[model samples]
Target chain A: MKLQAAIDRVSLDRANEIAKGLDGIVDIIELGTSLVKDYGFETLKREFVGLNESTLLFDGKTIDEGEYEFEKGFEANADILTVMAGSSIDTLSKTYEVTEKLNKQMFIDLLEVEDDKIKQIANFKNAIYGLHHSKDNKNAFDAVSSVAAFHKQFPDISNIAVAGGIDVDQAKKLSEQGIANIVIVGGKISGADDPVAAAKQFMEVIK
Target chain B: MKLQAAIDRVSLDRANEIAKGLDGIVDIIELGTSLVKDYGFETLKREFVGLNESTLLFDGKTIDEGEYEFEKGFEANADILTVMAGSSIDTLSKTYEVTEKLNKQMFIDLLEVEDDKIKQIANFKNAIYGLHHSKDNKNAFDAVSSVAAFHKQFPDISNIAVAGGIDVDQAKKLSEQGIANIVIVGGKISGADDPVAAAKQFMEVIK
Candidate 1:
């Protein structure tokens, strides 16, 4: 399994510093929705956010106006962009087509979506289906069991990612379970006192 | 009934110019989600986005991390901000509480959400439940009929708003319907040859 380090709820300069420090340490670096909404794509572009080794994913969480957001996100040099699975089918289809046409990547955030809805949107073969737990819900998320169930339910959809309060132990367990393609760790890595050391620890465990 | 002129898919300079021109012309001036994601809140703050008369609604479309987005949006001087009804009940609850505490307003965008979900989120009495049609769907929307049906279904929930390809005639009909508190017109008003004239026409008809 690959490791994705998500940096959120921080200043742009701090996020950039963290991203540089974690370059090549993690497979992907995610600039969460707070950064996008607080600072925006044009500013993100102006600030020079290219990584030397790892891919960059901007969590746009697009729900509508897919073409515009995807185009701007890609233009801003995002290797991967995210769209909400809860968006209309047309929106999802448009974003997926944009991602494919641009030869980039798209992550479908399956936060709060029912299985029936997932079944409808599961046909995007190249997209990564993300099993996300809401940040505000003070509930615990079992990454291993959720991945097991999701894989069993949607056997055809292969590229899977799981996030929400993920830690080193859960990352190790998910890696051992051999189901999820990517394990996304947010505050556990980005909020740590020493992000590089924390990322190394997660990388060691996942490997 | 109030008229909200939605400005979208335009440059920030053009948007600012249009907004300044439409200051007192419409009841609400919506800096659409495009503006928020394109230029960002920090840039908007630096530029100064206060209106002379109309309430400014930034379509932040807060899906998760509700409190943070709400706090930032309120600080950015938005008279009202939007949260998706498709969001988790927890997210909706947090955003609503923030809006109440700030004494601002929240508009719940009910795009692509089922009625069962609405039933769970409809208790925020102060929120304006907006019946929105997906822009990418290319489907015809009857704003008047949708409002009538929504009112009939969720009669206890007052303060309704409707948006989707609204024209001057439809605006007149919605005003006659007397169900929606706000009628949002996008390209019909902002994309017109003479936006102030278009806004005036809508205001006359709705009144």
Candidate 2:
């Protein structure tokens, strides 16, 4: 399992600092949606650099106008961009097409969609299916069981990522489960007082 | 019916000029999702000005982290922000609550959602239920009939807004139908050779 540390709800300078501290130490560095919506692709393209060894994933969370967003995101040098699974099939297909053409990756966020919708969009072989838990919901997330259940439900989707207030222990469990390709840690890693040390801990556990 | 002239897929300078030209002319000036993603709310707050008379609607299309997005969107000086109907009820509720507390407006975009989902989310009385046609979908949108059908299915939803390649003819039809409170004209106006002139034509028809 790979570790993706998400930096969110902070100034670009702070996020960039955190990102630099964790660069290449983690497999992926996610400039979360807050950064994307707050700073945008233009600014991210110019600033927010220093990820030489890690993949840079902009949590664009694009739900419409897929081609435009994906093209713009890639132009900004994003290794991975995200699209909502709840978006229309046309939107999904367009984003997937754009990602494939550009040889980048798209993470399909299964945030608030039904099993039926997921089944319909399960054919995107190259896309990473993200089993995300909503941050707004006041609920506990069992990373291991959720991945197990998702695997049982959609066994064909091999490239899986999971997120939502994930802690280091959960990351270790998920790694042991060996089902998820990427375990995304947000506050537990990026929001820590010492983000680099926290990320190192997750990396060590995952490794 | 109100005329919402959406400015999209254009440079920020161009969008501001267009907004300045149509300040009080149209009921709403929408910095479309493209502008939000490309330039961002911070740049928009600083640069994209000239809406002294009309309501400024930022199509943030927020699907997660409802409170943070809503707060940032409102802080950027948007009179109205948007949330996807496909979002979880928790997200919808949190956004609506924030909007209510701030005394702003939220438009719940009904794009590619099932009727059951629509029925469940129809209770946000103050939210404008936007019947948005996916830009990626290569299908015909009969704006007037779509609004009528939506009204018929969910009579309780009063504040209706419709968008999807709407033209002057359809705007007129929607005005006559008396269901949609707002008719969102995208390319027909914003993409027109003379956007201000096109907006005047739409304003005339809607009036």
Please tell me which predicted candidate would have the highest lDDT against the true structure: 1
**How many clashes show up per model?**
0, 0
Q: What is the TM-score of chain B alone in each candidate?
A: 0.98, 0.98
Flag regions of model 1 displaced more than 4 Å.
none
Q: Residues B21-52, candidate 2, lDDT per residue (tens digit)?
A: 88999999999998999878888889877578
In order, what fnat does every candidate score?
Answer: 0.86, 0.81
Question: How does model 2 fare in lDDT?
Answer: 0.92
Task: Please report, as a residue range, the 10-residue window in candidate 2 chain B with the lowest summed lDDT.
Answer: B42-51
lDDT scores in order: 0.94, 0.92
lDDT of 1 by residue, A61-153 (tens): 999999999999999999999999999999999999999999999999999899999999999999999999999899888989999999999
Q: Extract clashing residue pairs from model 2.
A: none
